[model samples]
Target: MPPVGRRERNKQEKLDRITAAAQELFAERGVDEVTTQEIADKADIGAGTLFLYAKSKGELLLLVQNSGYAEALVEGRSAAERIPDVLDAVLAIVRPVVECNRKQVDNGRTYLREIVFGDPAEPHHRDALALTVQTEEAIADVLRRDERFSADDAAALAHIVSAIMFLSMAATINRTNPINDVVQEIRDQVRALLRG
Candidate 1:
């Protein structure tokens, strides 16, 4: 890798501050309650400068949540690797994700909606697409390690599992159903998919 230049480093630092400030504010108050100006102020950047990083408050929330989701995926993958059963392993991978999103369920509802139906040109949509692909690859990797699932089948099955997970999570956005129940339901769905 080439050495980092001053301009690149400064840009990254600004992004880091923006991300940290957004996360803190969003957590303290819900996504809908936080404003772009608040985030910019917290980050010590001009409000106009914040727009250069994210087009809107929703995009800012998406950007902040993406990092948390990525970390959850890493933790989930590590936890899943230790499980002996493929079904349990997959649940391990998914549970952390649901937990992470549950913290900001309202924003999550909007985030998922934007991801599925938003403009292709939006940066958050692009980030979400990449995240989805990476998640499926992780699932496929786990399945490939198991004897029951073939490499060819693993990729397709990963897509199915992720779709089910996304739908299940979407359904829980406003409902009273316990998060564990949602996770268990997903586990059962995965088991049925594998058995078929």
Candidate 2:
């Protein structure tokens, strides 16, 4: 592989350090009590430098969420797009979530609680919604690439997929409601929809 360009490498390093420090702090202190100054101190950078990488607490949390989603998206795209068959498409997605959830078996509850119950009033909420739309659009691209689903169907399915993902994340950590059984039922329902 080609060596990373110096600028890109430096930027990534900064982001990595900031995110690592923030994660530790978040895990230790929770989001409300953890401030940018503290993360900067832990990261060995000025407080202003922290905001350069992360605008607010919400962006910091979103950054962490996206870090997980990035790997999941790549694996999902690779596994799903590998086949012309739609069942393969579903596998690409289901397999990644199951795999990620398995890998995150320990961290899932902590991360999920922080993400779901994290501060929605933070400045980055609107931006997060925009990013969510873009993500759905990207997922839509995969469904659209298949000739099986029309634009309308693809859009509807994309919404369904996004809804399932959101609900899965929500239910995964619910105290009264573990999602393992529900996910299976939901998967069966979606499979029927996809088949129809």
Report the number of the highest-lDDT candidate.
Answer: 1
What tens-digit string does per-residue lDDT give for candidate 2 at 97-184? Answer: 5444434343444444444565655544444454446556656776787788898888888788766765654564533444465456
Per-candidate TM-scores read: 0.88, 0.64
* Pairs of residues clashing in candidate 1: none
| Clash counts for all predictions | 0, 0
For model 2 the TM-score comes to: 0.64
Candidate 2, lDDT over the whole model: 0.65
TM-score of 1: 0.88
Itemize residue pairs with steric clashes in candidate 2. Answer: none
Residues 73-114, model 1: lDDT tens digits? 999899988997888888889998888877777777667776
